[model samples]
Target: MEKEHKHHISSYFAHGTVLVTLLVLTVITVVVAGLKLGPLSVFVALIIASIKGTTVLTYFMHLKYDKPIYRIMVFGVFLLFALIIGITFIDYVFR
Candidate 1:
């Protein structure tokens, strides 16, 4: 398969989008942290971080057009991690 040519213009847009998203999410995280959401605060922060990570991986890391299996694998990894986190959270909260 032929490699697609990446245009400089698109790169600018992607960079800008990533920057804006980072700033917006960072602000949100800070605000949420100050709101005292109880145990859910950690989960909310993690969810935001996950979104940022996936944005970086899918766009900056060029995984958006990767194979279907690759996408599935990446999603599966996130889900597995989330489940583990959930279990630990449940244990801690119930303790």
Candidate 2:
């Protein structure tokens, strides 16, 4: 028995738009790095990086079209990562 798999096709224009958006975000990150915002710079960079990561995961990795369970799992992983980072920061601030 042969099982047929369904695939979702995305347009080149959509991918091009994603590429442009990522490039714009990279530029913004660079510009923000040049500013002397002290601790805020790290927060800003992390924020931008998180956005880029989500974009890559959603579109480039095709997670957007995946099942809801997969999305929930990814969210859980990200939540764990955030919690670890927060704990590290808290420890650093106190020490």
Best by lDDT: 2
Error in Å for residue 84 of model 1: 4.5
lDDT of 1 by residue, 1-95 (tens): 76666632337878889989988999999999999999999989989998889888887766776666768888899899879988999989999
Candidate 2 Cα errors over 4 Å, as ranges: 1-5
Give the alpha carbon lDDT tens digit for every residue of 1-95 in model 2.
54554766878998998999999999999999999899999999989998998998999888898777779999999899889999999989999
Report how far residue 30 has shifted in candidate 1, in Å: 0.8
lDDT of 1 at 66: 63
* Candidate 1 least-lDDT 10 residues: 2-11
TM-score of each: 0.68, 0.84
Model 1 TM-score on a 0 to 1 scale? 0.68
Q: Any idea what lDDT model 2 has? A: 0.90
Give candidates' CA RMSD values in order: 3.9, 2.8
